[model samples]
Target: MSRMNRFLYSLADGLKGILRNLMMSLMSFSMLIGSLLVVGSLSLLVVNIDAIIQDLGDQNEIMVYVHEEYDDSEFNQISQAIMEAEHVVGFTFVSRETALEEMKNDLEEYASILEGMEQDNPLRDGFRIQVDDPANVEAVVTAMEGVDGIGNVEARTDVVESFLKTRNAVNLISIGLMVLLAGISTFIIMNTIKMSAYTRREEIAIMRMVGATKGTIRLSFVTEAMIICLCGSIVSFFAIMFLYQELIEKAFSSTGLLQAVPFQEVWGGVLLIFVGASLVIGVLGSLLSINKYLKV
Candidate 1:
């Protein structure tokens, strides 16, 4: 028989063996599905969080405040320095009138406060600069210090700092949860594989007596594992789509949050992660159980 034909026969035989032990196969497949679903959900959450952070970075803008007594030459020099920074995308100078007008529009409740300070307004002229990285806002602010006419710099520092810290914390939490879930899944899958192998002990012994090579014996178990995992991956893909549209998208949309979550862009990655995770768990479980049974 050709090598391809032999492989096909071996595959067919392996599948038949699994079908012959239908109960064990179903149990194994069920465990695989549960494990992969958890893995896929975590992966999708992480990916979407990362996308949200990217959008925030792209939209981040910094405001540099200039001192009251500083000369126009000093302001020009400070503006020129900021414009040269690599992280800076663009910069615009906000004149005193313009700043006052913006504040008047934004602070409707404080209209009297502005009217009282018409001539002696403490608000300073400033430059609004957009940067490539939200994380680099502090660095850009630091670079602007001591340049002529610079009184104090405020670029949503508190908001940006909080966001970075929160993003990192979320990532760490996601990783911890993923590791914990994976361990539980591995334990469950390993137990299931052991049970399946134990129940087929007699058949395995008979195959060995028939001069079956160790490779063939091991391949049979591994093939069953891969089939279970592949099926679970297919199922998890549909489950993720349902969850994304029905639960995730709806919840965020109701709150007017993450209006542009880029669901479709991240969908492919989520599927890839589920397939890869399922395959790893399945292969590991099968190998471990097969090794233990062979020793027995």
Candidate 2:
């Protein structure tokens, strides 16, 4: 038979093999989906945590308060000094009037009690300074303390340090879990393929006697494993996306407490990873399992 004909025959036989051993095929399919789900869920969690950390870093800023006695020229000098400071990416001046107005808005229910306090506004003008890196916030605060006309400098270094620690811990744990699950999944798949080949040993022997090439026999089994894995990957991808959407709607969309990374931004990478992993596991497992049978 021609090589093309042999390939087509093998492919058809592979489909038949799945139906012939439906129960085992189903077991393999379920295990693949389960493994994918666990890994994918953890991946999503890590992505969201990373997003939250980034947002917090962006929001973190050093507050530099100016003494109430500084004139406009001194304020301009202070601004110039801040702009020249190392690690200072940006700074916005908040006038005492603006600060008082913001406080009034925040205390809307008690606005009447503070209606006449504008003339005697006790708020101080300040600069909200953005650092290029959160780790350098303390350095920037220290530099600002020596600047003339600056009364106080405040920063939340402890909060940033805590967040960094949490991110590291989460990443280490997620990576360990993913590796463990992947190893278990691969082992299960390898054994399942081996058992399937064992059940068809008689047929394989007959094919060998009839001059069927080892390549053809191997392709048939590999194709069968690939088909099962592909189906499981497709199902798991959709199921994961569905669950993510549900989570976004129920937990994040209405409450506005936490933001989720949009599926639109990540689905392509997730699909590619799932499909690639499935193909690798399928091909590797089939090759390893069928090699023993083909040795005869």
lDDT of each structure?
0.74, 0.85
137-237 per-residue lDDT for model 2 (tens digits) = 87998999999999988899888777777778878877897778667767777787787788899988888888877888899899888888899899999
TM-scores of the candidates in the order shown: 0.83, 0.84
| Model 1 ranges off by over 4 Å | 17-24, 84-86, 104-122, 292-296
Candidate 1 on 1-296: residue-level lDDT in tens? 65576567657755775677677667766766776676666666666666676767777887878877787688678878887876888989997778988999999998987896668777778888888888887788788775667777777767667767776876787688677766766666666667667877886788778877666777767777777777878887888788778888888778876753656877777778878887887778778777755643
Cα deviation of 155, candidate 2, in Å: 3.9
Candidate 1, poorest ten consecutive residues by summed lDDT = 1-10
* Residue 116 lDDT in candidate 2: 84
Candidate 2 backbone collisions, by pair: none
Range of the 10 consecutive residues with the lowest summed lDDT in candidate 2: 247-256
- Index of the highest-TM-score prediction: 2
Give candidate 2's root-mean-square deviation (CA, Å): 3.0
C-alpha lDDT (0 to 100) for residue 178 of candidate 1:
70
